[model samples]
Target: MKYDFDEVIDRHNTFSMKWDCREIHVILGITPRFDEDTIPIHTADMDFRCCEPIQRALRAVTDHNIYGYTGVFPGGYGQTYYDAVIGWFKRRHDWDIKAEEIVYANGTMEAIRSCIEAFTEPGDGIMITRPVYTPFTGTILKTRREVVNSPLVDREGNGFYEVDYEDFEAKAALPSTKMFLLCSPQNPTGRIFTDEELLKMAEICRRHDVLIVADEIHGDLIRRGNVFHPIAKVAGPEGIITCTALNKTFNIAGLQATNIVIQDPALLDTYRKNANFVLPNPFTAAATVAAYNEGEEWLEQLIDYLDDNIDFVIDFFREHMPKVKIRRPEGTYILWMDFRDYGLTGDEIRERIYEKANVMLESGPQFDPERGEGFERMCVPTRRSLLKEALERIAAQFPEG
Candidate 1:
């Protein structure tokens, strides 16, 4: 591999939220549990270094050192910023989008918040399937909307979770339910919604007049055999709003850049009016163009590395920790593991992992209180050796029964 994903760069004292945030234990309601030596396999941020091309682009900005107020969209020779996303969707997803349809935002959550504020009234219902990404709920409540859960069905004996269409339709049928926030290549479970599943979901949301906010932020990180069906593709272009970014894929999240694509001019207008959020930093804008254009090779290589990591995780657990079950994620670097066999509550599991293993993982309850119980989300976007060591620590503490 041209990129050395195994290389570990020390992030301690770097002000990295994932690594340096002692306050996380406070947020998680645990005593501050870890030191600088703790392996934070908790947050979604990649432990590996970012694509070189993106770093180089940011470096050029630092070299200039002007640091003045910058325009929102790249202009002049930099019009490639627009062309970058346009060409990306076309080349990668086979989903063609126009320049006018694209809107820039700092992050996916910001875009979702804006969409919620724009389309839904306070106290209106927003439907989500769980267990899901943590921020999905945070953004909903932040905007004063009600969270309507259409929890997914946990298939018996198998680790895979499936969408509960009946519950979904019932939830959407609620008159107050205004929108559905869809996470493609879903975060913790890593299930890529099949075309059939997406069609069913789209039909229900459309029939009930619920707007669709598709967060395809993890779309590019799909495993080899899986296909990512964008909600817009199934739901059509009308009321669907697709949010995507290179932050997760290219590990440039600190840049705070994301792309929002909405085909409906009236809806876009409403969203822009409500969101009125800050524009991307000049470095982010510059690096985004570089990521969408030149970062493809790096992304492909990264996916290959992640694929191996996934395989290693599955094998390691099967061999050493058979009590823990994993479905083998279809997408995302985040691997959801079920520790229910140990009969421990989510908090118990989390506390054990922290105190005994000294590895920080996102507890399932943090995703959804009920569905997330007995589950833990482990991020595998780090060096394989480090991941193995973390797993060894965990396995040593939670040995197979």
Candidate 2:
């Protein structure tokens, strides 16, 4: 209650891709069948106001007004940003990492793309889950490597997605499959992976010599009762590059910053060599340092608000939309709602809901082709009142039986 979860902030006219993207709004009108303006909850960006401390720091940069060419890594934002992540790993996760092991990049997306390019050759194979963050597929394909799918299998009402271990090992062992991207506190599902699961995954990738790219970007967002483990902590640190950022946790994603931690110096060097594609600007550093250093209190408050939103969502589904099921995610503000019982195709459900209520949600198909069909990702970082209103609208879209 300390943070205002019911507060509404306007994101339109702010150059927000989620809010201001006219093209997507038009396309959405086709499927989700929205009017010119819709309540968009489809994209991953948070609707909350930017963390105040980060805004102050960016303002400080503007006041300086130098705006010259900036150096990458080991300066300004890089120095303090590195310390913050190191502190975070030690404080929250109980994992200690050397500052030298951490590499800087524009963001996790760019870092993953560079990792694919650096770790594998053309025609090599990469493995990732479908119904996953869409960029992972394109990043690997851009490397001219084949992407192998080990779709996350949902069994009955388990309310979680699991990889086919046999298929994973087989693909990893192939001479072609050279890397595997793991999204922990996974998006959509919000499942904080078990230690046993991460260990098994790391072992298979290790045995097959496939580099492990663990995207623990949501690690900092884990709830109080659950623990979010970094894969490298259990995997014993060989050929593992950990990609994470403060953007998701603090809702400062536009800061354009993230860290890539690789234990092996040689591999880290090669990754840096291949990562010349995008250089982060100074504001990225300014906002990042501000986030890591002074943003903890804000983050804690945000977490509490999100938990309330989660509770509200569950209540709404149970009372008004009983056909949809949720897993009560342990981390990540994203929720994966299962509507398989309704027997509507993901697209059908999405289109119908949007057409009826003007509420936009991430349809399941974007995560993967098969497993994603029954689910939708709803981000709960916005105002609880708005989230409630949106869910009610979505439910009203379904005609009473």
Candidate 3:
């Protein structure tokens, strides 16, 4: 409770993609059904203010006042940057990595794109689990690579998803499939892959010589009781490209900074030569250092607040809208709610949420064009009052018979 998460800061007119971008609807191919009163709980970014240390770091950068080209190691930033990143992983995740193995990237998606380009050629297959972050598929297709989807299984008929190892191995065995994009502490479903699961997937990929790019961007945002295992830690460091970033952890996605960890010397060299060189801006460097080092207290508190928020949503839905199927996610602040019990089409569901409830949520179809129907993803990092209000509005529109 040191940081005021309840404080509702206005993000309007801030050029925020979630709040200010009217063009987002068109971009997402969503019909403009929402009015100005619609509460947006769609995007993955947090509405909460970043930790104080990050703010202080940025302030220091501005105080210095010379916005010039900044190198990674210039002005003694190398040791601090490396130490913060190294210390954080070691201290928090118990995963030890070297500074030399880390490559700078602008963002997780950008890093993934670079990995796809560097590791796989055009017409090559990049395997991914659908009902996932849409960007994974988009990036693969945009780069002219084949998207080999081995859909996650919802065995219990609940929202919780598990990797289908049989299907995964079958897909990995494909001669054309050259890489696997792994989203640990996965988005949407928020299923934190267990060590067993990570190992099984890694073994399959390794057996088939399919490279693994583990996007651990959401790795640190787990629920209180759950543990997250990095793929590199579980499957050894060789031939695995792990992408880590402070953006999602600190609600600093706009900063566009990420570290690509490639422990294999040859793979690292290939990535460095193929991937675009991303220079670290002064603000980004300061924020990264501060976030990895001094932002833990704030992050812990934030996780606690998010846990409460998740509980609130679960309880509210169970009481007011029992037909809405949702499982408690192990990680991330997203709730994947299944509304198929209502017997509404995806378009109807969209209309009900956007027009009737005046709540903007991510439609299921956006994640997986086929299987993601009648589902919606809601992000819960806003003020509790706003979240409550949005839930109430949604519940009113979808009253139980």
Best by TM-score: 3
Q: Candidate 2 or 3, higher TM-score?
A: 3
Supply candidate 1's per-residue lDDT for 10.
91
lDDT of 2 by residue, 1-401 (tens): 14564677877788887777767766544243544457777776788876788889989999999877765555565566678778777877888898878877788898888888787888988898766887787787777889888877777766777777988888888888888989887886787888899999998887878888999999988776888899889767888889978778777677767878888777878886776745567788777777777787788888887787788898888888788889888898888888888888766787766676778777777777556776777887777767877887887787652
lDDT of each: 0.86, 0.79, 0.89
Model 3 C-alpha lDDT versus the unseen true structure:
0.89
Q: How many clashes show up per model?
A: 0, 5, 0
Order of models, best TM-score first: 3, 1, 2
Instruction: Give residue 271's lDDT in candidate 1 (0 to 100).
Output: 79
Better of 1 and 3 by TM-score: 3
Scored by lDDT, the top model is 3
Off by over 4 Å in 2: 25-37, 72-78
- TM-score, candidate 3, is 0.98
Q: Compute each candidate's TM-score over C-alphas.
A: 0.96, 0.93, 0.98
| Residue range 1-401, candidate 3, lDDT tens digits | 29999997888889898888878776787657645677888988899998889999999998989989877752365878888888999998999998888888899999999999988899999999988899899999999999999999999897779889899999999999999999888888989988998898988888999899999999899999889888999899877999999889999999987998899898999988887788888888889999999999999999999999999999998899888899999999999999999999988888878888888998898888879999999999999999999999888888662
Model 3 scores worst on lDDT over the 10 consecutive residues at 70-79
